[model samples]
Target: MVCAAMLILDVLSPLLLLSILLPSYGCRAADIPEDATSEFSVRLYHQLQAAGEQDNIIFSPLSVAMALGMVELGARGASLEEIRQVVGFSHLLPGVEFSLLQNLTAALSDDDSHYVIRFANSLFLQEGVTFNPEFLHLVRKYFQADVETVDFSESAAVAEQINNWVENHTESKIRELLSAEDFTSATRLTLVNAVYFRGSWKNQFRPENTRTFSFSRDDGSEVQTLMMYQQGDFYYGEFSDGSQEAGGVYQVLEMPYEGEDMSMMIVLPRQEVPLASLEPIIKAPLLEEWANNVKRQKVEVYLPRFKVEQKIDLKSILQDLGIKHVFTSNADLSAMTDGKDLYIEKAVQKSYLEVTEEGAEGAVGSGMIALTRTLVLYPQVMADHPFFFVIRNRRTGSILFMGRVMTPEVIEPNDHDFDSM
Candidate 1:
């Protein structure tokens, strides 16, 4: 069965706000190397691709990494090794990895009044379970995770409490994250992470300019959908593993958000090449090459206004990625508690993203001045087919969200009828 990507942490601040644009004091920008975050992003994206296949995928790699990192803190021996390998934490020093995560989380959550981006982490323990004081302190200090005692016996109430927390953090875009069926009497610990982001395009698409355009699916079939169009100077580049005519060629375009510090990079495979063909070659080095070589050019661009809401169960995916000891009888969470076997019963993540013409309030401070003259026909980069995208922090090179749009459809606002974890 195919599954949607689920991303997950945080304390219960009445308003758990962190800055994304401007760096918080003492949060050094160089702590987390750009290559490290990029490598993690690409690795997670490829894993999601293998699992989700031709389905639409949307999840925050950063959210998943932070959530798993919380679990990593308490892991020992084989559990620790597997977790590190799967989550890309093996390369950095243990202390440095935790510090980098703490710093990166603070930096990404810090945002101005223009964009709304927030990340939250929380831990729910079965009532009467005694957790290790050191584990609690570490999670609280690094991830700002709020710990709550919930009675697993009262499954309904526990589900409601957890769902309420998720709804509040995601602006209600994700509700009912946990249901009664997901909990059991043996469930001793539950860790959750939710992120909500709403940003307007730096170059807003005219509402009137949005027209029905054909989008090709993976099966070579086509469907008509609303496509937003605009012409402007954007960062663009082409990728070809060999000769362009030999078929491994694609286009990459960077569209910045209102703040200019965050942007989405769209990868459009050439018409003759299937998107699947390019998936295997997606890595940090390729992304770095694109970033270093892309040039500013005037072009006609078309992108679909899309929204993807996905709830995913991460157990299988984690196991497939070599994190096996954490789920089975060999689990070692002694750091968290000496309570009964505390293997993760359920690991779920719910994420929501909406792209529209309006960015932040003061998005357009200066009006555009166009001079009338003989216009030169600009190259067109139309994304009317299957493509992959990565929304990232320009300053940190941390991938906030990544996904593939296979079949673009006009999903009505507030439609929560998609698949559930």
Candidate 2:
């Protein structure tokens, strides 16, 4: 339901992976509110941005929302209220969000002919624990989650099985997401959610146009990376936050995938300005503004072929976001089972994204002067430096992935390139 957020063409790669695990909690139903989801996505990005500092960040806001939704199904008292408040779902009628979530995900998974977007949700419970049938039914009704019984005492085997399920759903792009150390005898239930997406660019870059180029990092370090160049018509705009917090000017470029249903929006700061200066101004309204304002025009684009992956500890992040009660001993998750002792032990999410040419021939742009001079006929988006990006559904306005590229793909130094010494 959340529409847009900050930066890169992450899902443009061959694969984009996200796997979520919550030990001892589960979710329930939903029709997701778009604006609410967008706000939540922006908030999540801000947290990840602050925590990551100058590092590259990539994660699926929708995946996390769904994971929490699963937990909410079994949550009661403060646990349910906290999730509702943090996610901005309090305004909606109770149980309506389940239908919303189901409809939104169903819409996304509808057209797989052009791109591949898959969602796999499952609940793994300890062999002896008896879960409430009605709660399980609601989870399946809204999230379509598969329910399985496993021996959590065999931590290693359980970890491998869960990781294998994640890998299988994500095209093996993300493997070994959970290790033996992630599970223990106290783990009675684990809710898993995996999202995998692969989409090709509408205007595919020619492989020949991709050449080694210098990528400047935020810390003034530079790395060699394969930069894909193209001169095509894309949604473009220049925006200013109207304050000193962010540099006066920034560029927003929206590149659609094979189907117009989805797009990748890249937000690039001025070459001299650090991306950190611009990130603070990124909010839900700003994202909507970017979505509405960009005009379709020819632009020169130079984006590096890169991959960004990260594993986030959701427990700490959620606690920071004022959702701590669910993970504590005093939590109320009786909706799932009769045992009042059930409390979430750990919540983790690992995401991976890669950007590539999608095996299409690229068109060389006209103009050596454009590359040489400071001024060019069309607006140019040269991502030779760090930038923020988001991959979203153009039609539904759901952000599939949001992240920033601080360092592009790096190639190590080779002896042959240096003087024969």
Candidate 3:
């Protein structure tokens, strides 16, 4: 099973507005199709890696794609083509991509008592702008986005309203996602997506077994972190780099959440190889191979309890991925509205993820018993160094969250100031 990440996308433009929030899921390798969402995940990961090297990087490609997909509905000429190419939608017939997205969203958002998941989208239009009825109908039908009119002249009030909506949808995990400066009299539309998920481990980590461990960083230094330990049967695999080059072998392990529908895949390189060496080889095919080949085995696992929060401006990254027209003077979005030069002014995303022994708080009970009868020592999979991880949905084959942990640290909830914005 694969675990998908939560993705949020917001598009700010002078005339056209688009926003998307989507939850992540993972499909079995055998079930995955050569579709736009699947292809876009791989391509966008590489682009993000190249743009932000060595620092902690995490954002949802699906979120960006959904936001762009909404934009595509109104994009014409070069703008549409560039978005389609960059998002890998060119391979599909017109409208097929959006239909697939709608189905995927519905499938992922299906209720589960074992998990808490939320995905929502909305459009905040300038009070006086005239948006095409066709565009509104498509967004409401396919994306289920709520459309509301607000006065951009009252920038602070608008920002608060948008942030309040985001905070409510995300269970307050993400607050102040937008600022007063983000809106102005010239701003015609703002589109937003918000997604939040919390799930428990199928085999919950015992709090008593948690202890401080040495975590090695990329720069050769080490830090002490609280690591949770568990021993269970998990899907595991080992991969070898076929090249005569210095890249060595790596281990992959999949830990399922309580329902066994979603999982976290961890890729750990051998001590001799740095995570940087492994990044170049990560692609959809290789990921699929790992998922298909992993076998169930009793293993010892040690993982750090950590949290990550990130905010990113996607304009330059999209530009690097050959999505240039939408942000420039040549943009043509006549399908959204008439007589307005509707180039995207900003594209931003904010994400937050926390992994703890209790899993997501309200979703699961805490009691779990460990098997102590094994006579032989199980193989160990220690995340003592930097490693890559993907949260995927097994049923849908979508990745909800993906990131590399170089220096794992616990972030107290109160440490972040949401009111400042």
Q: List TM-score per model, in order.
A: 0.83, 0.87, 0.86
Compare the candidates by lDDT and give the number of the best one: 2
**Candidate 3 residue-wise lDDT, 1-421, digit = tens:** 1111222112333332222222233222223343356566777677667766666666666666677878888788888888887787787787787887777666656663456665688888877778899989998888899998988879899879987887677666555656676666777767776666666788888776665656788888776666778889999988887872326678999988877877888999876677888888888777778888999999898887666556565666677778888777677877888754777755655555566676543221221333232554977788878888878776555777777787786323243311111
Q: Residues 108-148, candidate 1, lDDT per residue (tens digit)?
A: 55653345655577778767767799999998999888888
On lDDT, who's better, 1 or 2? 2
Error of 2 at 75 (Å): 0.5
How accurate locally is residue 325 in candidate 1, as Cα lDDT from 0 to 100? 73
- Ranking 2 against 3 by lDDT, winner: 2
lDDT of each: 0.64, 0.71, 0.68
**Clashes in candidate 3: how many?**
27
Better of 1 and 3 by lDDT: 3
Tens-digit lDDT track of model 2 for 335-362: 9888777776556666666677762222
> Positional deviation of 42 in candidate 3, in angstroms?
2.5
Give the C-alpha miss distance for residue 249 in model 1, angstroms: 2.6
State which candidate, 1 or 2, has the greater TM-score. 2
